[model samples]
Target: MFHSVCQVPTAKVCGDGKPSRRGRSFIYRLKDEDQVPQQVCKLFFLSTLGYHPTNDSLVLSVMGKDISTPLAPPKDQRGRHAPANKLDQKPLHEHIESFHPSVSHYRREHAPWRRYLPSDISMKLMYADYIEKDNKCSYESYRKAVKSLNISFTQLGEEQCESCLLQEQHVKADHQGEAAVNCPQCEKWQIHKDSATGSRLHYQSDAERDLPEDTSTRSVDLQKVIMLSRMPGVKSAVFTRRIVAYHETFVSVGKKTNKKNTISVVWHEGIAGRSAAEITSAYAAALEKERDIKHIVYWVDNCSSQNKNWCLFSSLVSIVNSQTISTEDITLKFFHPGHTFMSADSFHHGVEQEMKSRPGGVVFGCSRIV
Candidate 1:
């Protein structure tokens, strides 16, 4: 009977390894009273895109050979006692165990994805599941059971970050509305044909005209760092300190830090350094020891006073002309007004988290850790 059901076109594996609409007959030779397992029937039916079979339905089907003898009915339609078999004599637990194959080993084999989940997140999931189960299982009990099983989970779950969520929403909105899509620039430096043609009107060297000849490689190495906006003010008792942080995220390739990588800070009495001189003073002090760097490009927001003024530019120019250090050129790249999120933002977030964890929500005044 099982062989009869598998006569569909999908039951055959085609030469191209795809399901073809070519019907094929399946014949299974069996001796008298021989039985076929339920797993075989399930795998066979599911292969043909058929619905999965339940245990009760499969047991009562005429197609399957029953493993156990006929069980006596507790009460027939006429209330007569039916003949009993050895299968009816066992307990309810035994019957359930026989009907459902043990999935303990299978579940164990498939639980590797849980390792990427942090313990706290796993505990939260377990707690939620326990609550949803009407509090039948305690969290402590479930935790103990999991610990006894000796499972190791070390990876993070597939959760979206705020930036990713925002990007998704932006894409969806751009599609739905008439707003122009802010597509990511494919090339770092793109020179339009009109701009290039205009620049050729005057006979000048590409270097003299300040036109980028080779966008791929301008110097020996092009390492871009970040200089973020002023972070949250840290307050303690009577004194509040402003925190300025910097991060060299692209200094080395393939090396990543899970924590904040910020350095070189100035702690003023107020929230932050507002004046251009104070900001440049802190910046100069931070670069006092560094001498081997070739090009220092600071990606900062378009702030007029603190970072973008002539004072800061003149300070950098004077430092380059002094020849007191090995640094050659300094460039300040201003980010767009509303879209200036960088590694510095993440670093500031880490700092805020650390500060919140502290007593009285206070981070003491200090310079950026080297």
Candidate 2:
């Protein structure tokens, strides 16, 4: 069988004696006026010399007119050049090829990563890189570089960082001090309430004999500690009554800044009765000697069985109305369940920690722990 074959163009030597038959054949095949135009070769050489096709030449080339003398864009009936239809124009990549060198770097560098990567994925990767970039790089430097290079970059806020979100999700306890710092009530109490209490305390100390005994307002927190019940081997329940009194004395205050001063701690064993009456009686007995105390603000958690019941309310009212007691007005403030950590919780935590540090990690009796 005989095989038919087509002839391939033989390599030709240019003026520099470099052989390139492929380029020559392609140029010749264009067949300008049955021969390749001299300007075609000139333009090719110019392109090789890094001369880019100007906008004017590109417009003419796109319109299928010769680049040497590009025809003016046709005008409409209104005598203005008709705007090119973007839908009919070449693709962005083609336009990039025609763009001048001045802006070529911009177009080449900024091709969006979203074109290849999914938008969400690209954004996350960019944000991660932005954060973990040079440790010493300034914000302005990175931003300017991003702009110049056309990076697919996203800037996330401090809280929006992946590490920050992970940390927040894992956080177990609330920072009470930081929380208190932002509270307006806590701020005012620190500056005003504590200052007033200090003044009253000073006045009482300086002129206790001269001034007649009257009444004053006191703030207190009450909590029940049951370590006495959880004795080493025995499991009999004994409640350890913990009362934290806030006064204007120079004593070391607990962790809770709102509970400004630490006065005295009174503990009533379970033997004394764990009823509402017993609790109120303990509070009354502690303040009864302070005949000057007229109003009292008690901060406690809203445990209906213990503090918020009608029994406790009635007992407070009876004290104010009682002729024997000097207290006139009584206020009960209930804090949020888990967040009621100001004085009562602080005292409870301290007692529990101290008890846990013992040899057996348990408290047998109040006397042993105290």
In Å, residue 203's CA in model 2 sits off its true spot by 26
Q: Candidate 2, which ten residues in sequence have the lowest lDDT sum?
A: 246-255
Best by TM-score: 1
Model 2 misplacement above 4 A: 1-270, 357-370
> Which parts of model 1 have CA positions greater than 4 angstroms off?
1-261, 270-273, 360-370
> Clash number for every model?
5, 6
What's the TM-score of every candidate structure? 0.36, 0.31
Per-residue lDDT of 1-370 in model 1, one digit per residue for the tens?
Answer: 4443422223566788887664533232333345643323444554444446433254235333332434333345663556552222223223222322222211222453332234354555655654574544455655554544443333212222344345446556755532233454212112232333343222122113332211111111111222233234633522543344322222111113222123434343344444677667656754553445565555555557656789988998898778686777766655433334333443444444555565344342224433
In order, what lDDT does every prediction score?
0.41, 0.41
Candidate 2 local accuracy as lDDT? 0.41
| Model 2 pairs whose backbones collide | 214-292, 215-292, 216-292, 216-293, 216-294, 229-238
